[model samples]
Target chain A: MNVLLPQPYLLFLGETTEPGYAKTAFGLRDWSPQRCLGEFSLPGATVSTGLPFLTPVQARNAGARAMVIGVANAGGFIPQTWIGALLEAMQAGLDLVGGMHARLRDIPVLRDAAMQYGRRLIDVREPPAKIPVASGRRRTGRRLLTVGTDCALGKKYTALALARAFQAHGEAATFRATGQTGILIAGGGIPMDAVVADFAAGAAELLTPDADPTHWDVIEGQGSLLHPAYAGVSLALLHGSQPDVFVVCHEPGRDRVLGHPDFAVPDVLDVIDLTIRLGSRTSPHIRCAGVSLNTAKMDTGAALRLFDRESERLGMPVGDPMRGGKAFERLVKACLA
Target chain B: MNVLLPQPYLLFLGETTEPGYAKTAFGLRDWSPQRCLGEFSLPGATVSTGLPFLTPVQARNAGARAMVIGVANAGGFIPQTWIGALLEAMQAGLDLVGGMHARLRDIPVLRDAAMQYGRRLIDVREPPAKIPVASGRRRTGRRLLTVGTDCALGKKYTALALARAFQAHGEAATFRATGQTGILIAGGGIPMDAVVADFAAGAAELLTPDADPTHWDVIEGQGSLLHPAYAGVSLALLHGSQPDVFVVCHEPGRDRVLGHPDFAVPDVLDVIDLTIRLGSRTSPHIRCAGVSLNTAKMDTGAALRLFDRESERLGMPVGDPMRGGKAFERLVKACLA
Candidate 1:
């Protein structure tokens, strides 16, 4: 179901040591800064979103309507340690928002507290009750999906940036979020990963339904096609979204697939080629528009040169949305084209 | 959780006119005849399993331990009209078995009746609660999967035949079911389609875990790689099963994907190639051993001739599992090789 999250969030990063786990908080801070009031973290949590650290009461007083549980932990479970903080947030006059696999209402104490406080406990990961199987009918509107060479790349960032760029160019565009972080940022989306396997493609279709001919649904892609564990989700999204143009998201010099030691991250060209080959099952004219290089780990001068070299070599736009400049502008133009 | 079904089931076709909807009954009669006692259906049901029709009382008296809801109607819901017959079956001292998306227990009347009668209600479509994400670790056993050009071909039949053939040749083999019908016949399986999208591959891994190096897991496949709606489940099974050899199951006369008129059934070669390309991420040595031709609609003479021609063209064994002969034997041998 499309979750209508209350506005102005206080991101809750509960006892998470890894910065990677706190990506949800950082994503909101980076992409939807206006929606975020401040950050809240439990004791010993090393990660920070760089936003002002505010307690629930303080953030609520500052007009934060909800406290978003922003740490995407390994198992997507609500840790027992975080229960008190969640209850406290409810007591402090804020609704609770969660994107984890675990439901916020499932926690009895938190559920009771939310009920007592008359607060909403919105779970974004829960899919709608009745998603039909995909029709395989070609949708009318244009779509640009940002696929990835591996997980946790720049796919979401690229889609958000492209959607913004399209709007700046006076084009009708919408960022179709497919994951928890993206959904939280965009305020509503199908958590494609959480949907039943039978309805993965169907959910994608629902997320980006037939829009105006000139409108572009910039869908945020999921797992890599070469990823052994998640290629199914990726393929489902590819066929269902049926993107006319796609951007390959990759991280430079990241040789191995994250969490999968035996597998190597696929080349950007390989990702592009495979996406087109499989995505053509639905969108016959699907083509790679660009490469979204996640240059967050690379030196600026090196990243710039790599983008140029890759663009020339691949004959496509290669740019980092996080490092938007002339290259990103060209990438945006290519997507629109 | 693995289901332990009570043996010798009475196939229940509940007012189904279309033979296609009663495929589960037909499939059971064809593949697991020994486990079936007789057929039962509501009044006005045109479909039959060719077994002697018996009332629940007669079937129960005839040694039927369970009444299997055998009509796989659209939407996988138990029709309201069939509730009286189901309650009657329970009263007649038979446990109810269902593979529909709608849980049998969810029907309050039937749930209460089942509880009062002390009869088990088995819902095979429900997946296990603790399916982990795929580790992508190469498992020990040899696996042979039957892939399809489209849905409802002979994927399950091919896998069942191959598993039997492997056992006949003094090999250690197991038929692994991935769908509701397959699970019912096999008495257990992870309903791959019912699993959360994030854990599809993982559930598959659980379905076919590490085994003896010489053992073979003959995995029943699901949808086609080119199928718009169900390809996610197909890809997940492929990646998770990591089949060393796969048989392409295709219906000879069908041109379009079932229920999706806009999409043509993918070529067997394309299915093979795509399965290999995507499947290689998990099973690096994955390859197609042969083709399983569903030639039920063709005359015997034409079917044989066509098998030989396609075998020659594809440079692999081609046979109809239902029409087992030298061709089917060759296909089985090639799978072992």
Candidate 2:
């Protein structure tokens, strides 16, 4: 009588594949099936069809009683001290814990293994990151938007030109449930109301259901709010709905430095302080409020004068959420200067 | 007393998430508890948490075996025929089917339910279309060569530049051994000499059991010969090394007017033309020898001047296959004239 059962979750493969476990750890755009249960294999190991080879001891024996891996990719870009050492090795859940030493001073072996693994770390706490706000009232205040470039690039023309850059700022930008209310939605929070029906149902369109609108403060997160499920949905929307201004969008050709093998040379001020540590991973009342770019591959006036001189050295508006909100609210108070 | 053992070959995600499984027909790929095995109730999907919202009989009453449906736009590229009609309707021996009378020519009401479901019809055994060969190469002597692609974009950089383009056309290629050759060896098959040792592990880097040189002639297939176990190891090296000349290497991009969503595009030219429409597939002193092209995303001098003016409108010289062997014996007497 021995039962246990729970495994099947080792994840990884970022940069488009997620039809949420598209048939065992992603494959079938190029077809690689033999066996998979909760996959993360990333064709880094065989599959053109020499069936299920896996091995990191078969990904610690077929990953899934949980593991998520994919630290983006230095090629596509990763640092913030490699996502704070993979969120301090997933909150140091043992393997001798230790993490978050800030931008890891140019990796001195992950800064001496975060000073002997921050004494077997653990405080899996995380809260403070707000900024979702528009939860209702906007018929006169005005807001509507969408943005993209991951999950097969350009999130539906950056979320329908971010609802026509909030109905070109005269006000009331609409799309679903008319006078709309709020719904930001990126590659995130989509229980579908279009972001192309939540990226063609990957992860089964995130469990499918969303009328949103308690006047609509939807916003959304994931493709990388310093990631780890965009820091677990910005600390579950700052312990549930405190948002006000966060916008981040981006593509000064993947934040400067190129000839791309996916942007290798990064550091235009460490990718504009990794786009303001993705709004300082939520909670300084969460104020980043501006960046938007995906000009297909730049030159929109030299990517808005090098993203308006790096949103004027991050203080933050480089603007054009498909153009409006009065020049994206003067590029969000010149990026909240 | 519960003995239902045969529920093991599973798959499912949508026949409206299957419950008393009787309706919704197929086209699958959503579900991932490590490629599933039994018991059912999946819905955590992601790209920012999706799927989970079941209803279509509360996702077939959250229980037992098969389903995976999810695909919405793969033209702009890659959805793989809605994941082979939902893993042939969630796996059990298979049947899903195909399309055309010209893709139901403007969906005339699903072309009368595909002529009353002529066995679910998939564009009738695809990616194979061209045949007529018999041109040169056989002085009744030489043997094995295999090279590939006549279409499926860069099959491992044209099978390691057709093993250094068959040792710069003097023959002798090598890199043999196949063993689960999928995504370079993570236990998948990364030793064809460390897949050409670099160039991003191309011809499975010459199938290395290690230490090279054994007078060439081995070759093996790549992009795991569109995998039904490397297309039965490329149909047992095209029927036990009768080789002589299989070089193809495809993807000269567009001109087959619309339809290359690549699962090796109808997977390796529709299951390696069951040995080129049987005559026990080639080597009747083999000839359709050369084709190469991997000029990475075509325009190889405008696809060799549109295949030398369509090999002079089919009077042969099947377009500059490096031109001669008497213009491929006048393009094999204008392909069986």
Candidate 3:
């Protein structure tokens, strides 16, 4: 579903203390800094975007168009306690933009206040009304998908970085977002997780439609094929994308699937093998380009050595997109090739 | 989602002329005959369930408690012309049961009439309000899933037949439905297709929870793993079911996927291999029990010969459930073992 969010958003961090929960706010601040005015938070929220702190009234005075819900909790619900701040945002002449599983319009008070203040309440997570089943027909365009060994990895960052890299090389490319944070960053995208199971692949197909043969759609993936909770979504995204090439994103030292303790994180080689096995059903020439390693927690020397070892072991480029270097450049080159 | 569908249904074949479109009605008549009272249709509808035809008032007088929308088109929509008959059925004191993409309660006139008459309008395709992501933790009890090489081959029928066979052998078994027709026949099930993409597998986990060690849940599968349009749903069902044993369902001489002319029907062996490869992620001991052949279009002699040939080639029992012969009995024996 495409959304037209008013620019210069005031990020709302509602009672979130963990930096992980405030990833959306951080993501926008990092990627779309020009569009982010400042940050707003509830009383107990300790997380910050490192941007100027602004309340709804201050944000509105400073030309902020909307207050974007910047924290993601489990179940994607809008907590009852957050309602007052949301209403105040609308009262202060700012639109409310949410990417949660729950609809802002579903709350009676919020809906009434938005109408009373003549402010728009945009729910970015809502999918399109109609999405047909995937046709599996090969479309024009070279595409690359960033799959992961587990959820909450750097799939979105890798895709965004790769898309930028392709543009730096003077190529036609677009960053196709699939998840909520990515959707907010890209300004418009289908929330694949919110779509009906039968139409998931179709929604992906719609998200990245036919483009010029040289145009590269660096599609951000969701979940993981090895993830116990969300393999279906991953598979759907994989099939619908039919990427000519794919990159595996992984975080070092993660032994188990996030939140799913019963399942072990799959080997990167197994992920590549399975991706090729299933992805080839749609794109006959689907192949892995390289690995996008998340080395945020690693020391520079150790991360470099691990990258070299992994590259030698897997016979492909391995690099952290966040720490762009020769390795990242090589990975980017492989994606284009 | 479990539903208490008022039994003794007046099957409403709304403006349906082709028998293919009325598979839901035919399924109920054939499988759950005790719950099906009589058939009802619009003025010019030509299809019949080979049961007595009754109008709304006649059906109510004949002790029909519900009017089940029995026709399924491409989009699962209720036609504008058919709304009159649905309203009439409600007015006649019969609860309206529908398994379509369109909710019966969404229609203002029908909703008003249902409230006025104190009747229920049940939309069976709606998923539960909350579903957790799959844990991928193994549950107790045996599971036998019937997967297919293409859509509408006999996955549901094979599952239903196997459930009956297990009971006949003095074993506890339940037919777990995943589609609308199967849900109506079994009286309750999660419509895998209707669930959100991220929760498809999770919903399947909810469908067949832990049971007694000896009990078997015979799950009716959805689309084919090789099906371009629906492989995601098929994979979700496969992973979530984590079947101890699976039966590959295929129709002889079928060359292409239904409704998808661009893709060819996959070989049964490929389906078995892929199922094992993916299903093994969740079900470590997953094995192909046998093959369920749909020989509805083949002559008896030809069907028998094909079954024998396939059994020899696959090194497993192969039989058509509709033909309860020695081959089918052998297949049933293998399932129990």
Q: What is the C-alpha lDDT of each candidate?
A: 0.90, 0.31, 0.90
Order of quality (DockQ): 1, 3, 2
Top candidate when judged by DockQ against the true structure: 1
CA lDDT of B252 in candidate 2? 52
Off by over 4 Å in 2: A1-327, A330-337, B1-161, B164-337
Tell me which of candidates 2 and 3 scores higher on lDDT: 3
TM values, all candidates: 0.93, 0.25, 0.95
Interface RMSD of 1: 0.5
TM-score of chain A of each: 0.92, 0.25, 0.93
Q: Residue A110's C-alpha lDDT in candidate 2? A: 45
The recovered share of true contacts, given per candidate in order, is 0.89, 0.00, 0.71
The TM-score obtained for chain B by all candidates, in the order given, is 0.91, 0.24, 0.94
Backbone clashes in model 1, listed as residue pairs: A1-A127, A1-A128
Which regions of candidate 1 are displaced past 4 Å? Answer: A14-21, A40-63, A72-76, A79-85, A91-93, B14-21, B40-64, B72-75, B79-81, B88-93
Cα TM-score of candidate 1: 0.93
